[model samples]
Target: MRHQEGLALVAAAATGIQVGAAMVATRFVVHDIGPASLAFLRYAIAVLCLVPPLLMSARVRFATRDLLVVMALGIVQFGVLIALLNLSLQFILSTRAALLFATFPLMTMIIAACLGREHLTGAKVAGVALTVVGVGAALGERLVTESGTGEWLGAILVLAAALCGALCSVLYRPYLARYPTLPVGTWAMLASVVALAAPAGMEGLFTETSRLDPSGWLIVLLIGLSSGIGYVLWLWALKHTTPTRVTVFLSLSPITAALLGVALLGEPFTPGVLLGLGGVVAGLWLATRTPVASSDNDV
Candidate 1:
């Protein structure tokens, strides 16, 4: 059991890091492709990768109502979330976008609390406050230096994307309990691809795709493959561990994005980022750490 828990933690951490790297890669190529187009291509390729595993697995059936609900969730989670995130990159640095997105777990906690699925302990409330302050610190510095509405627009988009993720995280528990992770994830992604088609077409995806240089295509391929792999690992981790334990590992994402953004994209790592990162990390620890009595099961 300990070994399985350790593996789950590792898987969760890997997914978080993969997301940060994918963000950097998305920032690299988004200039050449429309947001909806990029999201469509990314998930379309991911569905291809996911389909093979699903085919080999034992068959599973979905009720008509459940199928429709899952498809709608997929459209919002993968379609709307990725489209918005990709769009935000056009206005903000990947590091900033990631930092802003790191609030996902906090948002999840709040949503769960609102739904009466989880209690808001004093620690949790404090953690939420700290995370909000941390995110504000990170963005406040930028608001001063940059002269434009783009930064604010990007911040709102990223937060909206995070909120979407948080809501899906809360809602997915029931469906995940009812289905195998691979089938659910693959079906969700496939649904998102179909949902995104109209928007992608509107952006001239067919025409713009031909213009991508080999390097750009390679990055897109990497993003798609990583997303598929990360999605599986995330689901597996969730199966083995509590959601708080799985999502707590997301603290690594902003750190990964910040370091990679500096090294690869030459984005600055300002003091505000440092302070924000510290607060976010501390907040996650405080927010998600189970009581000593529950720690054994949580792990």
Candidate 2:
């Protein structure tokens, strides 16, 4: 049990990094594609990537009722959540988008509490608050300068995406508890592909695919593949841990994005970013400090 918990923690952290990387990659790709198209293509390819493993794990099955619920959550995650995030990136930098996105832990905390999935503690609240303040500090000018302009729209959309993701994360716990993570992730993604097909088709997203160069196609493939693996790990982590604990590790994502943005996009690294990094780490540490008698672990 201890080993499983440790592994789940590791998976959660890695999921954060992979997600951050995907955001950075999306910054490059969304310029050439609409969000609907981007999301549809990304998850369509991701669904394909999940297929072989799912075939091997074909023995597991869910009742029709439970399957529908998971499928609905999948639509929220893949269609609405990712589609909004992709659109948000069109109007913001990857670093800023990541900063806004790093608030998912706070969203998770609130949703978990409201749903009776986890207890609300002072430390947890303080930790999420500190993390948000840090993200704002790290954002520096971007947060302030962009609000009055159209940038506010992007921030709101990203926040919505975070909320959607949190709700799905909290709601999916029961189903994940009853099923294997890979199969659950696979089915969810497949449902998303079906749900998103219409908007994507209306946009003629497939037409855009043919126009891309070899490098563009490569980027799409890598991003899709990353999503496939990252989502599977995310569901697996949720199987063994509390949603709050899993999401608190997402504080690392903005840090990862900042580093990756600097290296890849030549984005600036500043003193504020350093300060924010410390606060995020400290907040995550505090937020994840386990209560002695609480039932945060899913299993």
Model 1, 237-278: lDDT tens per residue? Answer: 766655655665666676676667568769787887778678
Model 2 C-alpha lDDT per residue in residues 1-299, reported as the tens digit of each score: 66787788799989988887888787777877778888888998999998987888658868999999999999998889999999888777666778878889889989888877888889888887887777666666665565434577888999999999999889989998888898889889999989888888887775554556678778888999899999999999888878887887777777777778678869788887788888877787777666523466543
Deviation of model 1 at 236, angstroms: 2.6
TM-score of each: 0.85, 0.92
Instruction: Specify the highest-lDDT model's number.
Output: 2
Q: Top model by TM-score, which number?
A: 2
Q: Candidate 1, after superposition: displacement of residue 22 in Å?
A: 1.1
Worst 10 residues of 2 by lDDT: 290-299
What is the Å distance of residue 275 in model 2 from its true position?
Answer: 1.7
